[model samples]
Target: MAKPARIRLAGTIAATALCAAAATEAAAQTPPDDSIVLNQQLQLGDVFSHQTLNVVDAQEQVTVSTSAQGNSASGAVENGSITVQSDQDMRGDAVAGTDMTFGGDTWGVVNATTQAQGNYLAVSAYDSDLTVDATQSNTGSLVSATSQLGDDDARLLGGAYINASAISNTVAMYGEGSFVGGTIDQSSSATVRAYNRIETQYIPAEAVIDSQAIVNAVQVTSGQTSGQNLAIVQTSTGAFVEAESSANSGNAWDLAGRARATANQAVLYNEGGSVVADSRQDNTAFVRAAATTTAFDFGRAEAHARGAANELSIGNNDIYVEIDNSQFNSGGVDVTATFSGANGYDVYVGADAVGNSVIGYSCSDCGGYLEARNSQTNDGDVSARADTTVAGSTRAVITGANSVGNSATFHVSRPSH
Candidate 1:
């Protein structure tokens, strides 16, 4: 086998600069808006027989807006509107390495607004490391829109109004190395008034690995209107080791809103022992309304893991609605785990809604209107142990409706030993 490339951080910088330059040239040939906002691509062949270091640091901020108006002959404006928008796209790749250390950090932010019957919006997308093959260690942090919004409108409008997304991390790592530590964070917010609407949507986070990996932490937050979060991890021949995730959503006053977190893990191993410990936490709060209208606040958490000759443990927690509301709503939590490997054990735990909701409403028509529907569904705990040659066990625990409308669910499956 050929020796791996011993590239230092300086060499990595030089290589990245060259790649950026090439990308810039390619971008220049295309229409201004028809190109990717940011892109990073790394390619390496062969393992690093010697110790090496590779580092990448990047940061960016963007804002975009547009407005229009029409005035009548009498100097009165018939219609006036404004629109704000922002978007980001990123890509990266790395192939080849052993006994090497890699570090990277990328951060981005966006602010958008529209006034006078206008709308405000913000969006972000990340697609990093299409393919990666490193046999040693990897450490990095990728974050977007973490700070609180300064504007008054943004603060009042809440978390659902801002939209942020991470499409996926298409990476593949092999050999006996460990992922070590890494974090992926994304957040955004938007505010609007006067017959306006705000919406935020996020796709699931995805990753694939073939070696021992440890995810130190992962966090996501959404304010105001609506928020959604998801994560998926797959390992073909190694153990996940340890992982943790947290998701939160702020107040939502009108219409339908939700906050959710989900994780999926799959491991395939024929021999040897494997172990996984993954935990997830979710929170949704301050869903209230003064008018006699309908409102929905939902918080959910889910996880699934599968492997052979291994031990798996998972936890899911949710906090749904902490303030009183005149409108009807529902909130809950869901957890699931699956292990296909023989001679292994699985454990799962879940909790939902552990807080207070003070009531204060002064609307004359509230009594006349029918009370809003309120419901919380807790699936309870479930576990199954299937065929196994040696020894195996499955356990599940759940806590639901500590205060208000909160539900928790859990499920586990394993082969008998």
Candidate 2:
């Protein structure tokens, strides 16, 4: 009688295991119809997320998302602790997602979008210390983002002792409209570091499409500042698209731009250890690094871009169209960001509307562009170091434009190395 009962119990347990396995396989990460999710946990060690959505369709989407103070910190700790906090809120009737059709019906939506980030923190409770109180608070409602159409964007960043990486791409159409808009916004990326603290940001405003109007302003700096860079353009009719991107390697290099900008920066500047750094951007970008505030001291930034629009069909694409779009562009060999530091630099004044793209080259799109149109365009670059340290640099311009369609196009590059 005991043997028979034991056998029966084992069989029941086996059946339950099989049902549980089937349920797990059929499950999906589907949130509520109108959902509000809050997940708070202290996860020490490794973490990962994998999402795959096939032939999806979504539209009339009113997306009011706020992810402020989303940060991470990791490194060698001898009897220490790591803490991260975030607070965010949204208000008002913003003119967004109205009459806006993101992914239309019968329109296969494959959103293969990825935004990657990294944080490096080192602590020695017995010898040294590091404190990171990164906070950004907004008490009153202010209309900072407004009147945006097509592909418009805005970003703000701050922190200390970090490793960051970023990539962005946009195609009027890619892979049969499947990947029409592949924008990795921060919507962008960064890799920075400091044993004690390091603060850096690469802010770029961009827009694309026909009958579209775009205006961009950016500010980057460190300590005191007295430097200028200019890029001006005068157009004459037709399609007038422009993009100005910048990259830097110095522990402190002030930048100001009035157009689109981007970078894949990696810094390996060590004070009392060995460090090696590598920054890469490819077709299907995948970046993974385990570096240090070690001993190696090296950094580099390179950039590249190409544009084309064969809209010679009818007289539809009218008006002035300027593009400050950045996609799959790369900055030179290696970058240096001190993963470990004893003292941090206090930023004083960082201005906006700054540039002179470098360590990279940009190619102009052609085949009879801006035909029979009035255009006055200007592109100028100015660099002011303001009595600071300078590093390696290079500038490349593809001269001899075929014919600018009775238009004025000015190009200038000034490197303050």
How far residue 410's Cα lies from its native spot in candidate 2, in Å, is 32
Residues 200-262 of candidate 1 have per-residue lDDT tens digits of 121111111111111111222222221222221221111111111112212122222121121
- Please write out the lDDT profile of model 2 over residues 338-376, one tens digit for every residue: 122122222111112212111211112211122222221
lDDT score of residue 137 within candidate 1: 14
Each prediction's Cα RMSD?
27.7, 25.4
- Candidate 1: segments with Cα more than 4 A from true spot: 1-138, 142-147, 153-160, 166-168, 171-258, 261-417
Each model's lDDT: 0.20, 0.19
> Which segments of candidate 2 are over 4 A away from where they belong?
1-260, 283-417
How far is 269's C-alpha from truth in model 2 (Å)?
A: 2.0
Clashes of 2: 63
